[model samples]
Target: MASSFSASWLRGDPRALEFLSDRFRHRAARAEAVAAAASRPLAPALHEVLVARNARLAPSPARERNLELLARPGTTAVVTGQQVGLFLGPLFTVYKAASAIAAARALAEETGRPCVPVFWLQTEDHDLPEIDHCFVPRNAGGPLRVALELPDAATSRAPVAHRHLGPSITGALAALRAELSGNPHADEHLALLERAYRPEATLVEAFADVLSSLFADEGLVFLDPRDPRLAPLAAPIHRRAIEEAAAICSKLAERGQALAQAGFSEQVHIRPGAPLNFFSPGGPEGARYRLDPTSTPGTWSLVGHPEGASVTTAELLSWLEREPLRFTTSALLRPILQDTWLPTAAYVGGPGEIAYFAQLAPLYAHAGLPMPLVVPRARFRVIDDRARRLLDKLGLSPDDANAPRDELLARLAARDAGEAFETPEAVEARLVSAFASELARLGERMAAIDPTFAQAISRTDKTVRRGVSRLAARYGRSITQRDQTTLERVERLRAYLAPDGAPQERIHALPYYASRLGSHAFLRLVREACEPFSGNLKDLKP
Candidate 1:
């Protein structure tokens, strides 16, 4: 949620978020953005890239209409994206899309202009390890991490888009088969995964197909920046980033100073002369090399590969013109490329993006690009009906179940023992309280009869109290043992809802829940739970 935590990204600054959050201010920005967008004009062929890509992945009438809406001069976009992740990566990927759709719908209503939700499929990123694996929830222990153990994956250093699923996928699929329930929904999801993640399917194809299977019908449009057609349109921005490397880097450093002054750190730190770009000399299967300026003016060298030749500014631009798809933006400049090509009114992102966007205000101003409104993706902890029932029976709320394993178990033990039988603490308290009162009356009588006998009464009371405490302690284990089903139920709740002591949404993948709860349940739950800009982590029982 954009609560105070998001404000910390800007700390002393609230103007931009405030402006976008307010209807009156948003209308003004929308009008201004429309005019500015008209003046700059994106290439006309942008829609063609989306249409062709979706035709292959997942296409629907709603998605086609949204693409048409986005192609128009006045229509704006609500954009969010992540790398083509394995099995949809974490649940926040789903959350990011849901929030974008909600924001797009809200922005359309508020601005009275057509708006579409666009998920930028980051097919160009070469971070294979980051998107190589995903966690699967188990009924016992916790979530199991299933990774495609392709032997070449580590050494390739190539983009996942270039890496096709290998025979190792069989083992990963086998893990899924062993772990997931044999219900009808589980069988269908398994079939879908098998179809999508075959040995020949590129990671990009598999990721796109599975995600499309889930959300394409909702009119969420996909844009792969790696599309060769988009390379030329984005080349200018890439050129500017490279051509003005020194000035841009200088401006970024100054912006870092400003952010530091405002209680934040620079999200991206390019060394003094490194441009905010990467060069992939080897093309699709090749490793991406960082673009850093050589000591000589107008000349640059690839940072990692020693054998790669240095190129002058003119040569790089010429190369970029010929093969723009070979170059891509660093995290800091990705939003610039996205907003430049699309009529983006607002961009929904998670916490990390929010922090980095704060560092980009100066960069955007330097590039003369209007910074889109940044909204935090909706956060949630999806609780199933089973977890809900367990929470109810154990007298522990979902929040309590989210506690650390040991702490939650201890509380559950105390609670279950107290209710079903009696915890040692409870028994001791009861025995002490019961005897203290009678002891006080008897002691008073003895003291009145003989003042010397008062000491004996006190000693006797102490002895009785000690004996009660000992007895309670000696039987505490037996009391906990009598918990029967309560402890097991609590463990099940922990494994599902708070695996590894983390929120389920952060730990478990969509496949885990989709198998148990149908995919439709996810679509409906996300749609219903979203409160446009509320930005809260809510609990929803599906």
Candidate 2:
């Protein structure tokens, strides 16, 4: 396999292009050229927004407890969380959350924030079906890929005890290892993974334990959204939401005919109102919520029990008016539950999360909540040390890595050609001489047709100039490709940097946390983002 290049060299010649087939230029040269082009300062608006938003928001009471734990002398926390499918599959995912915890403590120490990390279980997300399983790379020992697996009804909601998780998780690890044919250390890696998979603990617990030692001083706190205390906090909101949802269903049913004609889905855009389901810190349910899928399907079902035989939009509105308390409770309680415990100042998330938070900005405003500033998550493309060495040889950068394979190779050939050609002035002078001679000949031919054909002769002269220029350009492709690797690289980079085109698919799978940076790196980055950013839900990337 060909080796890759490192960032240092790639930055050197941002616009260098090469043809690998030519063998004169290694791929690294192109990479270095591209990286040089891509690296630039972040937009001013983004930076200002981040600093501004980080200044506001705090955590709920439960989170406050965790925060206080970190505040204690020499204590820390490892933290991470996911939208929903976080717990579905893959051992690397566990690492990502744990890594976030490790990163938080590291940053905390550097900044003297005494930060501890914690994982927030997104149990309430109604999109439970999405987080079923994980896929790893097809190659056994190399990269990672994801495949989806559905959770059984019981394990789906209730916090999965460690006993229920360990064996099955181990099976997954073994399968992953078996798939990786040439993994030299597959056995050892599997052993490490097996130890990390804690079946007796819930998903949050298992993740925390996996990273336990990383934050030995600034320890990890695990929070399951299903915890009894938290559930009830969401109860009033949940109840009111369910009731209002029924009404929404009723309205949808009534409008079904019209909506179908308009080609719209049954999705509703919820806005907080009258029956504020806000709960206080001391709610009886202690802010606990069960991970039941019914909350969602119930809202959509066409027929059901007491809430109504069938729901209408008006009924949904009535339920909202009836149970304002429940809805507000969840929002008010989140800060107390998580942020109050950590000294969080920012939230980092992917694009979707960022957009979702943006959508909820008005709700936060209405509830007297401070919206957190959102920052895009750290993205990485892993290339091993060998690739780095190869990059060094070719003097390339990551940005140059994606150009057409043929073009890259062609660059190498051009570099080897190394022969300097005549300058533009010389070529222009030759063209001028040739054009003058051709025009004179054309004039003679026109004169032979008629002495008064001067206009036709003039037009023929202009046409000859245009045609010669076109022919010259046609003959110059190979010459240009040979002479200017930098220009070639620039052209290739432009293809990718186009505003409308996405050169590669972004990885959003839960396991991305682990596979990209390993568990420790993943956890720390996420926790740092979530703790501070959660307060400003508007800041979370969609």
Candidate 3:
């Protein structure tokens, strides 16, 4: 089906178009040119670690089959990832997974090679505030942002994966249940959430459990980098980053400068003498610190806590070998580590990721890994019957919903005033034209007589125009007050379209829709509606 949505932003965003076609040129290459680049298959030991991780999550038959496929000689993965979020974060999370699956299936069909879809759970991310909250509209109006917070006693700068949901999750779930109580599938959605977000469950486990249940049949594999078993596999990449810290830093600095010169901002900055890897000062339970080189050659200290301890190059290597899990790649180096661990054919991400990849072309080359084809994930805007009726009542298109609340209301009020109210605007335009012509004739006559007199005529014309503009503003305000009901309808439409001045997909939680539409039905709607490599915003109607 054709998408019901339109995104004018896509027309002008060069990065979005670049990701869609996988080319700097307008046209894409043929099938043969698009063939997957050969990379070494996953080693048996690494494959076992992946399988064990999936087994812990209660893998489906399809996931098991995909895990088996990973062991094959030529199989490569089409990968995407996000932070473990509340109720799977925003709708874009689902869209990203669907995009990866679509891209993988298309690649498999085109090349006749096994290409599996994988979602790397960003369990190592320590930023708790980012994933702690999700927005859900209560009663189809303004959104309520529900936050699941860690307790003061338990709070630390540790990775979110290790943080338990705790008692606060109960209140958060209750809030969601109350908001979603009226729908037929409300119980089912709440049950799924409760099961995944139990008080004792860690954030990473909850995210995996929920996603596996949602997309089990699609054969999407989930990978957690924090899985201790995979730490050994990541050791080589980690070591190289530390050993070549100075060179990597220099390269990143040069590339960041080049990007700025080219009129694009660098997403990740390079800190001089800082290692591309983060070092956990207190081991697994401690906060992570950036490794910075010390004044002594071949020695380094943590960026913020330099007085804590200094490690020579030899000592750093020993620490990596003994405690591989303690070392994590910086944002700039994470993609390199991902490609190292998985034979990735393409890495699917949003627009911001695509821009950063432009800066990392040099780093990919330095790592001796081919830069995977970067593809834009699908974008969606979900619309229920209530929102549809509101749009129709307001004489607004889906695209019109993007306007600010005040702007949309003003436009609606003007339309409600009809042509009778607009007659004054027409008359004002004619008056302005007549006055312009008369002033020009007067100015010509005055200039012919005395050059300075023309300046006086111009000033008089400006004063007259200012008076007319003020009068027009007053007329518009009066018309708007007369059509106050239309303004109220526009307000309701704005709530659905752009809550808090942001798109619905960026704000609303997944369960909000699961309640409006049945859970299974909503999943099917997203899966079937998404098109491979189509970056346009889709409007999903229920």
Q: Each prediction's Cα lDDT score?
A: 0.75, 0.39, 0.77
lDDT of 1 by residue, 155-211 (tens): 565556677888878888888878886645788788878889888888888888888
Q: Which candidate is the best by lDDT?
A: 3
True-structure Cα RMSD, model 1:
8.9
lDDT of candidate model 2 versus the reference: 0.39
- Candidate 3 error regions (>4 Å): 1-21, 24-38, 151-156, 294-296, 299-301, 304-314, 420-484
Cα-based RMSD of the predictions, in order? Answer: 8.9, 16.7, 5.1
Candidate 2 has a TM-score of 0.45
Q: Write the per-residue lDDT of candidate 2 for residues 441-501, one digit (tens) a residue.
A: 8778878778877887678777876776665554344455554554444343323221113
lDDT of 2 at 189: 38
Compute the lDDT of residue 302 as modeled in candidate 3. Answer: 72
Per TM-score, the best of the predicted structures is: 3
* CA shift of 480, model 1, Å: 11
| TM accuracy, model 1 | 0.81
Residue 210 in candidate 3, Cα distance off native in Å: 0.5
Candidate 3 lDDT score at position 208: 90
TM-score of each: 0.81, 0.45, 0.85
